[model samples]
Target: MATFWIVIIAIVALLLGTVLGFFLARKYMLTYLKKNPPINEQMLRTMMMQMGQKPSQKKINQMMRSMNNQFDKK
Candidate 1:
């Protein structure tokens, strides 16, 4: 019975630790990304140009909005 309790306690501790770590990591990433988003208009424009497509302001704005929506979803 003592060993069983010990095992249960260990499992609970492990799960709690995992949940705490996940939240901490997520918070850190959110701050980091807010400071430095994964993509920028300049990069997107350059990418479009590289792909032989014209990078218009409307297109760039649309892409930026989509990128922001993706981040918000996560």
Candidate 2:
């Protein structure tokens, strides 16, 4: 009986720890991404230029808005 109770407690603790760790890691990644986005206007411009396209302001703004909307959708 004691061993069964011990097993149950251990399982519960393991589940709790897993949930806590997942949330903490998620929060950290969100904060990190906010501080350092994967892409920005300058980077986008550079990429476009490298692809042999002129980076126009209007195009840049439109791309940025679409990218932002993509993230917002998630």
Candidate 3:
């Protein structure tokens, strides 16, 4: 009975430690990504152009309109 309790306690402690470690690692990673965004708008546009995908002003306007609609819903 004593051994069973000890085992249960060990498992709980291990699970708690793992959860804490995961949260800490995720927080650090998100902070680092925010501090250094992977790609900027200009870089994305250039890459798209290289891939034969040219952006259009009409598409931009449509996207802006959709975004505005979303904001207005709030």
Which candidate number has the best lDDT? 1
Stretches off by above 4 angstroms in model 3 are 53-74
lDDT of 3 by residue, 1-74 (tens): 99999999999999999999999998898677656656545655676688788867675456556755664464
A best-first ranking of the candidates according to their lDDT comes to 1, 2, 3
Itemize residue pairs with steric clashes in candidate 3.
Answer: none
Stretches of model 2 off by over 4 angstroms after superposition: none
- lDDT, each prediction: 0.94, 0.93, 0.73
lDDT of 2 by residue, 1-74 (tens): 99999999999999999999999999899788867879999999999999999999999999999988887676
Residue-level lDDT for 40 in candidate 2: 95
Error of 2 at 67 (Å): 0.5
Number of residue pairs clashing in candidate 2, backbone atoms closer than 3 angstroms, sequence gap of 3 or more or interchain? 0
What's the distance in Å from true for residue 10, model 1? 3.2
TM-score (C-alpha) between model 3 and the true structure: 0.57
Off by over 4 Å in 1: 1-7
Cα displacement (Å) at residue 18, model 3: 1.8
